[model samples]
Target: MLNMKVGESVNEYFARTLAIVNKLRANKGKIDDVAVIEKILRSMTSKFDYVVHSIEESNDLDALTIDELQSNLLVHEQLMKTHVVEEQALKVTLGESSGERGRGRGGMRG
Candidate 1:
């Protein structure tokens, strides 16, 4: 079991979790926050009090056994897809706003 010092604060634990999440996101070629949820899930019970809350809330570990890791790759893939969707949505919204502003300006004059 992971052990953490008794005086460690929750905020510090969360910060560590965020760092791990960011690292995982970087590995997947995305630089966004979508992976945060999953990272939080993994951080729970991390050999210390900093463990993520998600895992504790679920009360289910049978599904997380090593034998199940391969099957769970699909879940990771879906997470990546979700990140792409969010990134694309942000891009689309920004583009639309820019276009509207351009139209409001009555087009560019030569």
Candidate 2:
């Protein structure tokens, strides 16, 4: 199992995995989808622990396709990135004075 390295994008990780799987297939390794899915779920970084757990609990690994798993992870990755950006923007806005602001979406923080 090739563990997803820290800071590695999901697409990159998937590409590397597919490459390895292809090589195995070329040599008649008889690898299967469930095996690949389990390996990926096991090999993800700790940041994905919750998502991995959710996937395992919610889906039948035997029936889940690799594409489906990749799509799920990609969505989670995008959400994570959006959340980080929102947090940083909130920090910056909070750092600025209220009077300097023209318009904002969020209401008063209490």
Candidate 3:
């Protein structure tokens, strides 16, 4: 949702991302599978990595006179979006899996 046009400082985008991630975490209960959940959390890091590399390789940075310290702020923003989307998708998958597990066990106990 934090769609900024050209020349938007990465810092602004990053703050918005952190807000959203916090909101999501606040809503969800402790996930049962820490390993799988951790993998989902890893998406944020991967997104940051991609964004930093992209900006570093961008024409905006390459021709710069200054030693551009690649800010992962905007990268974090993009990563947060990806993380939310993936988290939702995984939740759906887990819900379905839980349903299947119940059916496999012959439904609820009396």
Candidate 4:
């Protein structure tokens, strides 16, 4: 499904979520800490479902801070990005290596 923050980075997603939170606070909305936390946990992309579950199971939603959640997701995002880069590099290396396998074998038969 099309969602904020889906295709966006964790930082970008949190930026959008926090903006809405701030606006609610500014308007004197009675949004409680648990409510805010739940909203964030629920609104995250499917990629973070596991992280969100871990946080929910391990911590008290009433005590978790937005900053903490954002960082948790951000770290995961960075790690996933690093892995993707590494995988791409490996693929390129393998492709080039295969193409050079017969380089010094006296060339193809005439």
User: Which has the greatest lDDT?
Assistant: 2
Residue 6 in candidate 2, Cα distance off native in Å: 0.7
By TM-score, the better pick of 2 and 3 is 2
The C-alpha stretches of model 3 lying farther than 4 A from their native spots are 1-47, 60-76, 97-110
The count of backbone overlaps in candidate 1 is 7
What lDDT would candidate 2 get against the real structure?
A: 0.94
Model 1 per-residue lDDT tens digits across residues 61-93:
533532233234335445656988999999989
How well does each candidate superpose onto the true structure, as a TM-score?
0.31, 0.86, 0.31, 0.78
> Model 2, range 1-110, lDDT digits (tens) per residue?
59999999999999999999999999996899999999999999999999999999999999999999999999999999999999999988886766556656785688
What do the candidate models score in CA lDDT, each in turn? 0.49, 0.94, 0.49, 0.79
Residues forming the 10-long window of minimal summed lDDT in candidate 3 = 32-41
Kindly provide the TM-score of model 2 when superposed on the true structure, using C-alpha atoms. 0.86
lDDT of 3 by residue, 28-100 (tens): 8443333322232233344355654655466344243211322435446766779899999999899888765
Residue pairs that clash (backbone atoms under 3 angstroms), model 1: 2-47, 2-48, 3-47, 43-52, 44-51, 44-52, 45-51
TM-score of predicted model 1?
0.31
**Native-to-model Cα distance after best TM-score fit, residue 12 in candidate 4, in Å:** 1.3
